[model samples]
Structures are given as C-alpha cells and as structure tokens.
Target: MAHETDPVGDLTEAQAREELARLADLLDAANIAYHRDDAPKISDAEYDRLKRRNAEIEARFPALKRADSPSDTVGAAPAEGFAKVRHEIRMLSLSNVFEEEELVSFDQSVRRYLGLGADDPLAYTAEPKIDGLSLSLRYEKGALVQAATRGDGAVGENVTANARMIDDVPQRLNGAPEVIEVRGEVYMSHADFADLNARQTARGGKSFANPRNAAAGSLRQLDPEITRARPLRFFAYSWGALSEPLAETQSGAIKRLEALGFQTNPLTALCNGPDEMLAHYRRIEEQRATLGYDIDGVVYKVDDLEYQRRLGFRSTTPRWATAHKFPAELAWTRLEAIDIQVGRTGALSPVARLSPVTVGGVVVSNATLHNEDYIAGRDATGAPIRGGKDIRVGDWVQVYRAGDVIPKVADVDLDKRLEGAEPFDFPKTCPECGSDAIREAGDAVRRCSGGLVCPAQAVEKLKHFVSRAAFDIEGLGAKQVEQFYSDGWIKEPADIFTLAQRYGAGMQQLKNREGWGEKSAQKLFDAIDERRVIALERVIFSLGIRHVGEGVARLLARAYGSWDAFVAAVDAARDQGGEAWDGLIGIDGIGTVVATSLVSSFAQEAERASIDRLVRHLDIQEAERPRTEGSPVAGKTIVFTGTLERMTRAEAKAWAERLGAKVSGSVSARTDLLVAGPGAGSKESKARDLGVEILDEDGWFDLIEGA
Candidate 1:
C-alpha cells in the first residue's frame, strides 16, 4: 500500500485531513449530479482518480478518515419526485481496477481471504460493465411487481411504471420463483442516442450529453408513456433477493435469468482464473465501439455462489466483484480552426477542427467546443474551467477520447502555443444565413432568428424528418436529404411525399441523376410509399415541432388517439385558458414549457400549413391503447396503505395493475377506492372524508376474487 513517488503518499497528517474533507465534498456533489440529476460534472476517469487518492490518504492515516467518507457511500440519495423503495437486499457497488497488475493483486487478495494458494483454481464470471443507470426489478409469483433504482444502496426510487414500458423488461416470468429481485443496467444504444439527438435538435429540445445521460433521462421520466417511447434496453447481469437458489454459479444464474425471459449480456463468460478474466476484458475493449451500447469496463465476479457468500461485502462495495475500468486516453493535437455549425434548432455549435491525432486507437481530427462559455474557458454559471484558460485558433491542446464516441479538448498546452495566437472570438451572426443570432437570458446556445429561411436549419430539419425514429424512409439518409435539398427536388417534409407524383413520370428525371439509376430511384419511391402509412406517433414526430421528440409525440398521440383528433384539439386549444389548453398541459410529462412549444407549432400559420399538406399525403393510424375494456376497475385510481397481511405492497400494486386499475401512492379526492390494511393512518381518514370506497384486506380480496 506504499507509493514512494506519489504526491498523496507524501502528504502530511494535517494535509491529508484537509484533502480528505475537500475530496469528500467534491465526491458528494459529483454523486448527486450523476445519480440524481443524470448529469455528470466530471469525467469518470477524474472521479476514479479522486476516489483512489482519497483511499490512499485514508490508508496512510486511518484515524484521519472523516465521518462522511466517500468509501461509506454508494449512490446519492434518491431524488424527491418518486416514492422511496427500501431494498430488501442492499445493492452494493463493485471495487475498481484500472491496471492489469491491480486486477492481479485483487485476485491475490481474494485468494488470501479464502485461505487458498495462488496456484489454486478460482473461477470468475466476466461481463461488460454498462455505463448506464442501475435498476432492480422485483417479481412476485412469476409476475413483475416493482422496479427501483439504486439510490444510496439501501434505498431506491420506485420506477415500476417506467420499467414496465421497457420492452426488455418482462411483464411476467413463465417459470421462476415466488419472489426475486433481478438487478441490471438500463442503457441506450448508440444509434438510438444519435437519432434522439437529431429529433431533439429538430424540435429545439434539450439534448443529452451522451448515451448514458440519454438512457438515464429517458428511463427516469415521470410519464410511463415517455419511457415507452424511448428506445431503452436492459441487460440482466446479477440478482438480489431470491426466493430460492437461482444456480450454483454466477454464470449459471445469468443463464437462468435469460431462460426465464430476461436479456443477459451475450459476452458474459466464465473465466478459469484472473488471466482469462483479463483476456476477456481485452476482447471486450477491442469490440467496444462495435458493441452498439456503452460499457465503461468489465466486471468480474466470483463464479461460485457459495464463494461469493463467503467473500461477502465491505462497507459499500462487494468483496467478490471488481470492475476493470478502461484507462484514460489523451493525446496532444494542434487546433487548426474553430468552425460554427448551425443545428436544425438554429443553435450555433462550436467545433474544434484539430490536426489529426490518435487517442485510444481512433484518429480524431475534430472535437466539440460545446458553446461560447466553453470556448471562453468558463461554464454556464461563469465558473472557471481549465484554469480559465481560453482556447485560441492556433494553439497546442490536449484532446481526450476515453471510451467516448466524441473527442474533446481536455487541456491546453500553453508552453507549446504559437507566440502570436489570439483568443477565439465567437460569431454574433448566423454564419449560414446572415441572420441575427441572439443568445437569450439563461440560455446556453446562441440561436439564429432566420427560422426556416436559414438553409442549414431547413436542411437539417428535413434530414431529421426522415430519421430512423421519425418517418424512417430507407435510401433517404442525410446525404440524400442534402443532395435533394441542394438540387431543389425537396425543401420540406411534405415535398418528400410528393416526389413520386412530381418526378415519377417514366422515372427518367430521377434515374439519370448522380448516384441514382432506375433501380435506386424506384427503391427510393418505394421507401417513401412504404412510409406513407406510418403510425400517428411517427407522423407527429416527423413534423419536427419544437420540444416534441419521440417521447412527447407518443404522449400526444395517445392523448388524442388519431391525427384528426390531435389536429382538432390543437385548433381548439389555440385560445389560451381553454379546456383543451388545460388538458394538453395535464399530461404527466407535458409541462408548461413543452405544452407551450407544442401549441406554438400549431399556432404558426406557415408551420400549420406545412403540417396540413403533409397530412394530406399520408395515412396516419390511430394511437395504440392498452387493453382495459372488460376490466372491472379499469381507469379507477386505487390507493393501498398500512401493513398488509395478505401480500406485500409491491404484490398488491402489481395485482391491481394487472386488473387494469390505476394505483396511487396517496389518497386524494380523485381516488376512487382505498384499500386499508392493519395500520392505516391519514390516508384512511382522508379517504373517509372524501367518501371514497373503503376496502379492508379481506374485502379487497373478495372484490377481485373471480376477476
């Protein structure tokens, strides 16, 4: 545990104490931002470095370990929106290893703890450690009962409704125990993330930083409909509370979960020893980008369930498992120029064009500058960054791409900078359309006021309209959209639907075009024809209305049921303070901002004309609805309170939902029924005062006996 050349190792007792306190505050803030807000202020490498330094200091001076030490915490406390769920079995984290030697030492420590020789055989299961939100799904009697997030290890947030919306999460298990809590990571694929960002930009919505943030934000949405619209997926890798033994080994348990209708990682393999584990880690890292999803590292766990039990856990992390994190990759590069790209939303995005340099194998020649504040070496709040060193056009900068698809400037090499280098001056006007680019108060982006007149914004919006999550016309990608736009073949979404009608006279016009022959032109026409009968949600999303991404589109679609109904509602809602306006804002995920944006899209004369013309050429289907027609309690809100003698709260809620009943956490005037248990309190009194139907445990069971 000694490091002769380390700065932390050289710290005095007093210095170590002060450093620990500072590190404690920094780590606490980072955890809250990452876990609660779904926004990380620092990189994973930086967080790991700080944690390692704190641990080293704590080891050097044990007595100096502060009461609020980072080692004692797992995730941050659950945010206030959702009801708290106390985990039956604590969801412990895993220790980390960033080097092969450290992984070897970890194996040695496990062997020493188990009283085994280094030569003795030890099996471990290695799988990709997903860079996403941790969730625990509880099943009761072969039915999915509840889902919770990993909040502060011992407690979590109830996300049962959102979990049910995820396609990967099985609603019911065919053959499983009476009770089981399956743990896994909820992640978004790279393609989905890109598509989501495209839709966000098209609609002038807030875009996520990365796939991890996108997945977290999508899955944690208040409305289940929003979560359902998101392309969120899960990979079951571990388990918590189990009614019976799943399997004798870790790999076997994963297979069992897969067999019982769960998606487990395909790369999860049983390694004979640490060498094999590290080999698997290397293999996984090599195929990282190609894997489609985000994985920060490889997790290795004791294969034998009995061995894991014997090894047990430390304060917050498990002793039997370790995460082999990918090393941070950085490289020095020259800043050739700073280019400003206008997005579909008219946001002026700054791009740093760098001299080609390889960071972590891939050759990176461009990196994101984020916004004006970032280029000026300050954050949104005017906080200093990179020691407040502003970037210049011609300067030596350090670029980092550690496992991220996007490369970014991490630091500036001041010593290597050119003598005459000057600070970058961000543009005040739209570079594409010569429009007034204004930065509104409290907004991070400077946007073009030219609206649809801006060619860049118009072309980008057209591209997004045909994106995978939108209209999804095959052979009509970004390149085709750009080509068609430049050639004046298509200028808007409605123009795409009429391409065949306007230019399909013998197909000669399109066939003779560059990159197009008779077959290719015909294929494009067929693709457009195929997309003419899209679903209502897809049609709504294709419009690229502000703040209306796939999630909002789905919510709006479900609320109105059909395109005509949706249009009618929008027309009726034109008058402020009307019932239609109130109803639009009443949707769970449709806040004031989103509702206002949606209404504005319809209010604008030009936008409404474009939408009407588009609707004329397409067959928009009715929104899909859940099957609740014949259920007795369909649409009735019910509340359960106190200690139930017959079933757990999760079981009761699941049962009620299965019967098509809506379950609420508290008893309000809107509550139709209240199921009171032995220790019912304020809720029961409120229910009585409201004259809502009351049912005891036996009465509730009797009411739903034959349902």
Candidate 2:
C-alpha cells in the first residue's frame, strides 16, 4: 500500500502474492463502483498506486499473477440501464507515468520498440488528460449515428440520446470519413457543476461528489430531457474506428477534428522530446486550478500515426501513449480502528476506519490497509516504511488522495500515538463462519477454508453473479440479491434463472413479500427471462470462479466458441496432463495458473453441478466472431514469418485481423497462408513441408491489394 519507497522490488513471493490478491479485489471493486455505478469508492490516485504496485509485483513474480489481474482489465462492464454497444475498435486506456524518470523510460521504451536511436526525432502530442467520462461518437455519412460510454474497452453503454443533448457534441460532421468514431471526454465545467449541484439541492436531490461524477451521471441519464437540461461538454482528442485515416500525425488529427465541428482541446501542443513534454506538463499544471474543467494529468501520445500502429496495444493499454499523473493531495486524520472484511474469494482484507476528514473535497473515513504486514510497519522484504512506525488505533496519521478520489493512509504519527495503542493481531479464523483462515505457502493473504459455507462469501458470490459483467438481471441489484440470498430464494447463479419459476405465482410468491408488488415482481421475472439466453462469455463469468474475469472469460469464450465446447474442454483438462490441458494453457492469455483454476472449478463436484444446472437454464450463444466478409483473407489462418518490409509485425498482425484472417505465430498444417519475408527460415521450411500456401512480401501485398 505504501508506494513511496519503491517496495515492490523487495517483496517476497508470499508478500507479492498477498498484495496482488488484495489489489485485484480492490481494483475490481473500484472499477465496478466507478465505471458501472458512477460512484467511486477510492480516489483515482489511490487506484493508480495500487494498480502500479500490482503491475510491479506481477512483473517481478509473473507466475503468482492472477488470471483476473487488473493489468489485463479495463473499465467494468456497462451498467444495466443502457443498451450495450460493442466498439469496432477497442477503447484502450493509456499507461501512466508519475515522475520524470518514468516519462523518460516511456519515451525510450517506445523508441527501442520502433528500433530508433537515442537522438531519433520521435515527436509526441501532449494534451491535458481530462477527468471525465470517456465517450465515443460514431458518425456514418456525416451524421452522428451513435454515442457510447467506454465500458470494459470492448463494449460500452449506448448513450446516443444523452450525447445529442450536449452542446459541445456536434450533431453532424462535414468532410468526415464514411465511418468514423470520434473519441473524447464528456465533462462538466466548474461553473456548470456548481450550478447543477445548486439545482439538485433546490430540487431536494442528492448532490454530486465532483464534476466528473456529475458529468457522467448527467450524460448517462435515461431521459434525454434530463441530459438536455444538464450543461455537459465534450472535447474530441482522438479517433477510434475510421473508414480512412484521419491524419498522418496526432496533432493534425486534432486539428481535423476541430475543423469538423468538434471541440478539440485548445491546450494541446506538440513536443519534440521528453524534456519538452515535461515543460508542457509543468505549464498545464500551473494552469490546472484555473482551467474550469477537471484534468488529472497530461497525456503524451506518439504524434506519428504510423509509429502508433507499429507500436499497437499491450492488452488493456497502448504502447505509444501514457498519462503523467499529478501528485497526490495530503491531509492528517485520526486512525479510529482496523477492521477485516471477507470477500467473495475468501481473502480477509483489512480496512482502516478513520475519523472523517476531507483530503480533496471528499469526506473519507476509511482506507485500505492492503495486508497485515502493511499495518505491522514492514514491507515484503522486511524493509521498514513510514520510519518503521506501525500504524495503531488512536494514532494520528497522514492520509493522501491521489487523483482526488480515495483517501489512503501514508504515514503514522508515532508522537501522537496513544499510550494504550497496541499492535493489531490479525484473526486466524474466519469472522463470518469461524472456519480456519489459513495462509498457504508462498501466499501472502490468509484465506477462509469455509468456501461457500461462509455466509459472507455466499452472499458476495450471488452479488457478483448479477453484476454488470455477469448476468446483469435488470431488476436485481445488490440489495435484492442480498435479501433473496438471505431468504433462501437463490443460492447460486442457476437459482437466479429459476427465481420466477420458484416464486412467481406460488404460495411463496414474491409479490406477496414486503417491499415488492405484483408489477415489480413481474418486472424482475421479465428481466430474468430476458437474460435466459445469454452470451457464452457472460455465462462463464457468471460462475465467479477465482482468477476468471471478463477478459479471461472472453478469451475462453472465443477459444471454445460455445458453452458446450468450453465445458468439454474444461472436463478434459481436469486431468491436467493431456492435450486438453496443453490446449487450455496454449490460449494467448491463459497461463498454467489460469488453466488450473478453470479445470479445478469443474473438478469440484458441487461447483460443477451448480454450473451444469446454470447452463441447463441458459441458451448460451457462441462468441461473436470478427466480421471479415468481402475480404480475400476471410476465415483464413495466416502466419507472418521474418521481417515485413512495408509494415511492422504488429501492423501486419492488426491488418490481417482486420481482414478477418486468424494470425498465428507458428506455421501448421491448418495454416491457410504463410507470408514469408527476407529472414524467414524454419517457419518457411515448415510451411513448405506442410504444403501451406507460401507468399513473398510482394506476393502477399499483391494478393490482398484492394481487399
């Protein structure tokens, strides 16, 4: 939790494991609250710190990384109220750099990846990283067709009506491509936010926490009239999918967007190098307070669009851009007590309950302790942090809000420690079920062995099942899930589909229950029935298996294509020493750890039965395949060998993907085409021996020239 001292390098395997687990939970919760609920539990600064720590630890101990690691995740799945919109081009997030060294490293990493020398003139466009909801506006034939919120990168919430109400958003574009997705930030200005809050107060409604939240809430309103009444603005900074290239350079693209009636940020500037970028960042920081709109950092993107395509993406973030975040704001508060809360995964997370204090205009009374070691004043490697002073109850402590979002304890004031303050003794038994909470070897956090028997874990699993990324039953929310679970109406995900059948019109009808009526109960049943036929990925994610997240679920869904295929593969892989196991681990993102988790879930008799029952109630749809109609390479598995002259390997892969061809690293009998370049050797020979279609660089270009 203490990132001030660069403690990641010194963390032992167990410590790293524990911290990663904690981070995964924290980040997952934060992403859901912020992205789906529009109510953030932690500050952006705290989230970034935890995310950075998770990345560092994973980099150090890759084997211990969870399959649902935050590094591979984006925003949470879209909320229930809005229609889902799948982005043609994924809305990836930019990596971050907090210090000058990190910024330099980012520049050098980009240069090295592009085979550039130290003195190479790699220009970048630096602009303010707007602190607002990310919106993607799709225009077809110069008319704004749809607008969506960035939800989990791949899919988003359709908010076209709400977007049309924003004055800054253009209803139509002139001289734009046939199909273009203009991506930018939808924000509320300081004055607009103040006025909106005032209006809300006048109407006896709940006021917003910040302008970002206000803008996000307003833009996501179900009623377009409400959105129209709200003063929301947009700033076009980038483009997603395009029929044709917008510009050769990033700066030129911004200008083009501005000329096309989009409100492009006026402060955007081009920088020659890291030094110039830093200078521009400093200038922006100096004007941050008076800017009227919120900005968390300065975004620096490689100006050359070709270079950007060459660099491409790394999982959830881009390789060519980064956000240099502002420093955290600090305040002092009294540490009231430490409390341990159990999670769905059985990890006992310690949270610091604090006296109410406002760090960055938000009153925060709690902060995550990370792990027991964090409270014990020692890092993973036994290195002392916070001057080796342990945080105790009845002590004054320094708290900071990074990104002005969540408060986190940074330093303990030993001089202010009370005489009777004692070291916290972590519980060895599950507080909810009294089961043995044991820490496994090489594991940092103590997990409850109670499993599903624990009430806390059971309730949380049910909550997760209906979460935005899962079944997302419209009428069923957290409170409803909790009440129904407590009432024994639903115990597992399968139970959710069976809810209407079990209580719709029986003596134990939900309509007869308190706080529920005939219409409401029927609505809930309708929502449940509406989701009876769900996507394969959602079905997999709804199981709530450890280490399995939305991204991993998508990967598994894409690999197997259907629920039956996925189940068959999981059952075959349960033995863990056969071709099934190998295939499971061979998926691009799935590692041995994830594969084992998938298999183990099915191996359990009870869990497997639950999943089986759930599937029986679901008409699981196959994963959607990429549309490659009208392309010559559609449905073909192609391998690119050696060096590509016209484009980088990444560019070739992306191009091939766009053409509906599956790109493979190695040549096999199934290989439909092999594009070989100058340095091709073993793969070329294999392709020839395997009788695969082999094409030279020129031949490859000729074959797909127009298509």
lDDT of each: 0.86, 0.86
Q: Please tell me which predicted candidate would have the highest TM-score against the true structure.
A: 1
lDDT tens per residue, model 2, 1-707? 22224478877787778788888999999999998888998877778878987888899998998999999999999999899999999998889888999999999999999999999899999999898999999999999999999999999999999999999898988999999999999998878887888899988899998888898899989999999999999999999999998889999999999899999888999999999999999888656655777787899999999999999989988999999987747556678899889999889988889765445535456888887778888887779878788888887887777553456788886866899888889999999999999987666688898977898898898889999999898889999999998889888888888787777765347888887888888888889899998898898898788899987887788778888888899898888988988999998679988898888778988778877888888888998654466789987899998888999998888678667677889888889999998878778878889999899889988888887
TM-score of each: 0.51, 0.49
Error (Å) of candidate 2 at residue 275 is 1.0
- RMSD (Cα, Å) of model 2: 20.0
Candidate 1 — worst ten consecutive residues by lDDT sum?
Answer: 1-10
Error of 1 at 669 (Å): 76
lDDT digits (tens) for residues 1-707 of candidate 1: 12223487577887787788888999999999998889888877778888988898889899998889998989999998999999999998889998899999999999998998989999999999888899999999998989999999999999999999999999999889999999999998877887888899888899877788898999888888988888999999989999999999998899999999999999998898878998999788666645777777899998988999999989988889999987657656678999999988889999999865445534466999999999899999999999998999888787878765689888886876798888888999999999999998988999998878899999989988999999889999999999999989898899998999999888999998877999999999999999889899898887777688977887788778898888888778777578988998887568777877777878988778888888888888998653466666767899999889989998998678667677889988889999999868778878999999999999999888777
The whole-model C-alpha lDDT of candidate 2 against the native structure comes to 0.86
